[model samples]
Target: MANLQLAVKGEYFDAMIRGEKTEEYRLCNDYWNKRLVNRKYDCLIITKGYPKRDDFSRRIDVPYNGYEIKTITHPHFGDKPVKVFAIKVKLTRSNYVAR
Candidate 1:
């Protein structure tokens, strides 16, 4: 019944609401590992750009499934393949706010 909060750009936020993005990627360095590894979260709370805490319109709440470590070559990470923790999530809940 816990939650993990994250701040992302508008495009990724929109993509999630559109059912195109299901997993949130985090770098596999010590920073992320300390927070995501062996952590159990019930919800994933994401913000469009670190808006005010009460600004639900710019935020997304999704069910957190879990996470797995993976290696991928995504531009967000850089021009080379990198290791990351792919945090699983879903936007199929009735309470999802698509704004």
Candidate 2:
């Protein structure tokens, strides 16, 4: 299984924790698309924090929640119709710590 790290806004993070959101969408990017596609299962650690300057690292070490990937969709971005990755997930654990 692949271990993936994600950063989400506070509101969306709350929804995921509350079991209101079952899917997450990521902006279409080469790195993200490659990592998320063709995976049977992925372990996702969702957090509410800003990523570091490098754009991949997060400032926070603790995760807000964790999930397992159930399905994935690669859809066109918009008018330009670029591809983007969307994942359907199921909450497996909650590690939310109010900050």
Candidate 3:
């Protein structure tokens, strides 16, 4: 299987790197649905912003535990709850696959 590449930055990225965050959320829209629906990913290639391809320190290769569609209320979604794809990930010392 291949990897799902995600561009993230700031707090979210740092949280994942520090093992404080274990999941990522994607809005349930056409764009995300097309990329995530019916697709099987081996892992999540999380990058901080648009870093160089060789910048592993700014990238995190974490395990793709699973994913599910759930309705939830979040700051990004305002007051109304919306559906989102919750992508489960597991970060660890060995997860950063050095090339």
Candidate 4:
């Protein structure tokens, strides 16, 4: 049997309210062989900010108007050496709430 392992790390960035760019960070890995095999690559965390309703149909860009970001780490990957998954949150002007 082959030995394999996987892991994931996540980090949340502070809100940027005047630039117009939301940034996030994370670490992940892809496991090929192990007690369990995992073959997926996706962001374990997603973040968004809630802006007040305005005359504009769309919401201002997050970075442009300062927005908050929250990151979460999933348990798909345990603790092994794999790959790094850097996450970035881009919020466009919109009234839509995060689902």
Candidate 5:
């Protein structure tokens, strides 16, 4: 099991917390693809922010909630064989403030 802190948008965060969004998609990157693959269990912390392409410094530290990774999938990106992390998670807690 791995403890991973991920930043998500406010809307998506709300959806996940409300049990509307079950799966989360991550872009195909070498680091993420390697780290996420074959990981059976994950303690995912949902932060109240999203990654910006231009400014990487703009981020929130407080976690909105935590979830347990139920399943993982490697989905194709377009026509190319790309590794994407399709994480199916179950909400553990809400209003969780990360320290």
Candidate 6:
């Protein structure tokens, strides 16, 4: 099993920049496992500073073979520091799969 690392940087700032409320959640990188082989995968957002699990499925949605998705607050150079977070998921297809 391979791990697909996904990250969301400046998530807090993006909410402020777009004039939207900050998502009171964080990626659940701990409970994530790459052993699951199901087509339908789930990513549980493990909220920091809180003892609860919240699923921000609407905000952080990606398909099985999705490219790396990064979130930043600003577009130009020399802006706010970009905070990077990473998550690992499993890949469905294998190159050595029999044709």
**How high is each candidate's TM-score?**
0.89, 0.52, 0.85, 0.25, 0.52, 0.20
Q: Write the per-residue lDDT of candidate 3 for residues 1-99, one digit (tens) a residue.
A: 989998876688889877788778899999999989888888888888988877777788776776889998989779999999998878766766544
1-99 per-residue lDDT for model 4 (tens digits): 222111212222224223333543233333312212332333222322333344222232222221222344545445544343333344543622333
Residue pairs clashing, model 1:
none
Best prediction by TM-score:
1
Compose the digit string of candidate 1's lDDT tens values, residues 1-99. 689998989999889888898888999999998898888888888889988877888998877778889999999888999999998767776859555
Each model's lDDT comes to 0.85, 0.54, 0.82, 0.31, 0.53, 0.32
Write down the RMSD of candidate 3 (Cα, Å).
Answer: 2.1
| True-structure Cα RMSD, model 1 | 1.5
Per-residue alpha-carbon lDDT of candidate 2 for residues 7-97, written as tens digits (9 for 90 to 100): 7877776686677986667765677657655544434666656654554333222322332333343443355444445555465444333
Per-model root-mean-square deviation over C-alphas: 1.5, 6.9, 2.1, 13.4, 7.4, 12.8
How does model 3 fare in lDDT?
0.82
lDDT of 6: 0.32
Error of 2 at 58 (Å): 12
Preferred candidate (lDDT higher): 4 or 6: 6
TM-score of structure candidate 2: 0.52
The residue-by-residue lDDT of candidate 5 on 36-88, one tens digit each, is: 65554335555558555444333222222332333344433355454456655
Question: Which scores better on lDDT, 3 or 6?
Answer: 3
Q: In candidate 4, how many Å is residue 8 off?
A: 14
Give candidate 1's error at residue 49 in angstroms: 0.9
RMSD (Cα, Å) of model 6: 12.8
lDDT of 6 by residue, 3-80 (tens): 332334455424423445323222223333232223244442222122223524213322334223235454532366
